[model samples]
Target: MQNLQEGERALTAAVAAAGRTRLWSHPELGLHAFVDAAGSVRLGTSDRNWAALVPLVEATATGHGRLWSGERFVETAIGDRLAYRGHETVEDGGRERTTIRLADSVTGLAADVVLETCRGAGFLRARVRLVNEGGTPLRLESVTTLTLGGIAGADDGLGGLTLHWADNDWLAECRWRRTAFRDQVVPLSRSVHGHEGRGCFERCSQGSWSTGRHLPMGALTDRDGRAWLWQIESSAGWRFETGEREGAAYVALFGPDDAHHQWHQTLAPGEEFHTVPAALVRTEAGGLDAAFGELTDYRRDIRREHPDHRTLPVIYNDYMNTLMGDPTTRKLLPLIEAAGAAGAEVFVIDAGWYDDDAQGWWDAVGAWEPARGRFPGGIQEVLDAIRGHGMTPGLWLEPEVVGVRSPLARTLPPEAFFRRGGIRVTEHGRHHLDLRHPAARAHLDSVVDRLAGEWGVGYLKLDYNINIGPGTENGPESPGSGLLGHHRAHLDWMASVLDRHPGLVLENCGSGGLRMDYAQLTVAQLQSTSDQQDLLRYPPIAAAAATAVTPEQAAVWAYPQPGHTLDEIAFTLAGALLGRVHLSGFLDRMNDDQFALVRSALRLYKDIRPEIAGARPFWPLGLPGWDDAWIAQGLRGRHSTFVTVWRRGPADGTSCELTLPHLRGARLQPSVLHPTASDSTAEWDATEAKLTVFLPRPDTAVLLRLR
Candidate 1:
């Protein structure tokens, strides 16, 4: 083994800056972080080291960032005010780890900054742990997981840096945009005072929908072409911001704060609380793509080892198209038989099975037991039918909420549900469960165990549709704090369940991508990207999903219905080609021609699905627009590259050209992988490094595999 020099790599720390600070080096990516004697953190890339000391700390307050802190400020980890306590370095499985402890000089509060760098992953994982060192309890507002100071440096200013973030909505997720700091320029003259950031760039996700409004992730590219990508891997409420302080640039991220979700906690003496982990990747020569690609690798590394990561099975759910929540034993038998014949490995029976009331099933949920009135013979018959077709049986469950009119809603104690001002919080005909309460966890665990243990259930589509705004102010310091506790409890419960039932598959669906965060992605088998019935609007969402999620775990709906031409059917199926193939619609009603096209797409998906696990995403037309006439997305694997193009609306001609940057000079054979209702053509322009596709009309798509 070779002994590397101090402060060269592997998160080695050493004295620097005339003994004023300690420098920690990230070897694989060549990024350096400095902790001053005052415990202020700073960052510098290999391309450019800093000349002025930058303060690496951010908190929810009125003085920093653009967002308001809800008129409450608990100043703890906010600037150079914290004192450097001590640190420890350890090694595990050839990976180096460092945990640096910092404390508030005025108060009996302290925090630990955890840093981990692997051998060759070219990324670092950072998280913070808050501790109360006082004899009395201490109140806490919010703290950042990781803060990078000197993003652009004091002398140079933020003019050289570009800020990048993604806007994620329900149906249209992972829409990324880049902006230069100079564009939103807020000039601060050094002649008057020191550098102070103005007009800070800020973003946040409210409520339980972690990705509802915007992704808790962003990136900064410096003038020297070096880029840094940072993501807060939390499923609950989170926020991140970029701002200029003096001539330097700073970035701060936190899980939850009082301003957004009314969250604050009083830490008891000797108690500790840890925030969610954040990932940062620095690229030496490449820009955003290079940094983002490294982030993709980091995302894969954080995911738990599971069978879904390997098998990449095709799933069939009878919710969007076929059943539409009117499930019966009679109706499910044929769909089950047909889906199995179509080669779907998992068969999920969607909602409407738990209803016995004549009104509807929406308000009669929470009692997960199947309604004998609807099934006539027993729900077991349908389960057996699914198994008889050689497919795994799955069920849809909304375990976190109790319908307003449900019997359990009236029976369970009010403490089990989220409450504000001594009353239970209700939204959209439902009451949100506070998983921190023992009763709530017990009820949910009972429901899950009954379904999985007794009924032979293998897969679960966990769906959350409602959001209790702000948070639950049951008995915590604030509503946001209570919600954060519930969120942590929920994750712990999920980990326990998965540990107990390793083979069980959990599908995450929060009104489709609304609650799609890394915390859920680590536990859930797959995520349903959207429930957009409009196939036309789904292409952009499906195409851009790879920016925030792995294509392998992303499930896009492909519902081929009757009265559809072969081209139209292929278009719908192609929407799900690059991601998970969630086959839908009334397959029992399709003719031989229509059914053949459906099966063909599934077959093609199975062939390319394995590559998706190891593939890297590239968009030729740039991050897709909501109403673009043409869109192209590509996935480049080790051996072959798969590209899908959509000619959605009116176009000038029968052909359009797309550039594949990864295969610019390589000789490749291009083939139209899917035979649609109409004839298609693909021509490779070697000199231009573009592929020209010939299509007959609008509302059509095709998959081209370049080998």
Candidate 2:
């Protein structure tokens, strides 16, 4: 034991020395390895590996005799560190001998490794640069591997969780299986599933068979596919899986197979891409959510630095229904008033604010004018009405589209619009504005600036109805014509607009849920789940919202439509409570019963808004194959809790049972707040292993106060 301790000390000293040397001499190079004070060794570097490997391949081609490069060593007080950062000139028989340069603006040296204490979590972040450094186009097929330390004889409890691979259109064509070193390989070909329209692949295995587990991590392409590899592991007590992507380049605290999240990038010759993978390590205490919260908070800080940061939640109202009928400010004012009375934070006037001409929806899109016949006084009247109701006013705009018949169409040249066969084509009722053009960007900036700076609008709902063609006039070119880069540029333009209008809240909508990715979510606070507004549709919508994003980020809208009833409306409103609620129903058309229920729900939501905002929810019932009854609990602090229950269909004359987890050691008292019950309150001890509570029919909710 003494000798082992001495050996560990020596290892730690050596790692520390290596870290110090790398940090000093070549702070920006390949495969840097270092050790922190906690004795965890970290190896990482900026995408330099692609460049480093290029020289080796070239040497092999040139038939160089065992092409070798000298290593440079640096000395520190603890130990010595060695690094190699030069080109290998090689010669292979009958192959062209090539000397590959190790450095280029995009293909060269990048910060590759970080081994340090990040926010109190001992972690190792490995980054590698993937550069197209060779004359012949190259593709990357790499896998990230990690070997567990101090677990040679001990068992790593990866068995408790499951592994899920995110499904993608690209990954669907391939067939694969998960194989264990000592155990049977699990065939997961059909096991892969899709959620919220994205792909999710899953498998479960026990880590007790061996101290190490190898996961299939490389992109299965012979030539043209490249991907950055990410791997994370935590102390066994956590509930989340070891291999999963949660829509971002990270894992979730809930479970591995729960969802797949990743950021994808395609690189062209002489072009490079960069991404950050944040890791959190909990020493047998916190879960993935706790770690994610740290990253979320960091992102929030970055968002706050932007000039336009909206603090209040915004909802979609009125304009979506305009497609069915003429939506005038007078028709929308009452609904806005009711929504305000019902505790709506912001009211957005959706599409149809402008008049369409022969040129299509594009003509009126960039022009921020209300239809003269619909609103003689213009949009300011609607803004005033919303503001009068004590709610922030938001307006929808599709600056990226232009109607050919619009007044600006004659003013702007045809070259400003995206064209097909020399004619501006219409898509989804609008013509795409060439956002890739500098003049078009300037026009959009001016349009947004006028609304935010001049019109006093506090919020803007930007909509994109169709996908714009990747700015390549020719067919697919190398580096892929900067499709994502142009989209990112458009995003930057929007961010700049927000920077100019600091108070404006931007809600992104791509015909609803199409652009619901991390890039858009990072800039926009809320996203529309779907265009549908029926109350019954809220369950699947809310479930999808829960799966893809946090409840706070979802913007769920509901309207009465044709078949929805008052009771159904209230129950549907209850579903919206699980997320950020948006109202679009005709408030004036509702009877007294509907009004009263809306008032009650609004009061209840306002009462526990903070709890709803901060609490972590557990879906005890709803969707997941359970009946029409649904139960969700929001727990805040240690003693305060809020619970919502909904009984759909006829309720079957039988009460549903609800069991509360994580509520031990407290006295929980639940009460029915709606539908007038004789015995409203029930007291029980929460310390029991499980407590089953009966839920009445037609959707019932109980608030539990712990003392």
Scored by lDDT, the top model is 1
What's the TM-score of each model vs. the native? 0.92, 0.64
Candidate 2 lowest-lDDT run of ten: 71-80
Question: lDDT, candidate 2, residue 692?
Answer: 49
What is the per-residue lDDT of model 1 for residues 360-466, given as tens digits with 9 covering 90 to 100?
77876897989898799899999999889999999999988898889899899989998888889988889999898898899988888888888999999999888
Q: Residue 143 in candidate 1 has what lDDT? A: 74
List, residue by residue over 248-307, the lDDT tens digit for candidate 2: 111222111101111123345565543222232222222222323233333343233433
The top-ranked prediction according to TM-score is 1
Per-residue error (Å), model 1, residue 245: 2.8
> For model 2, what is the C-alpha lDDT against the true structure?
0.43
lDDT of 1 at 56: 42
Global lDDT of each model?
Answer: 0.77, 0.43
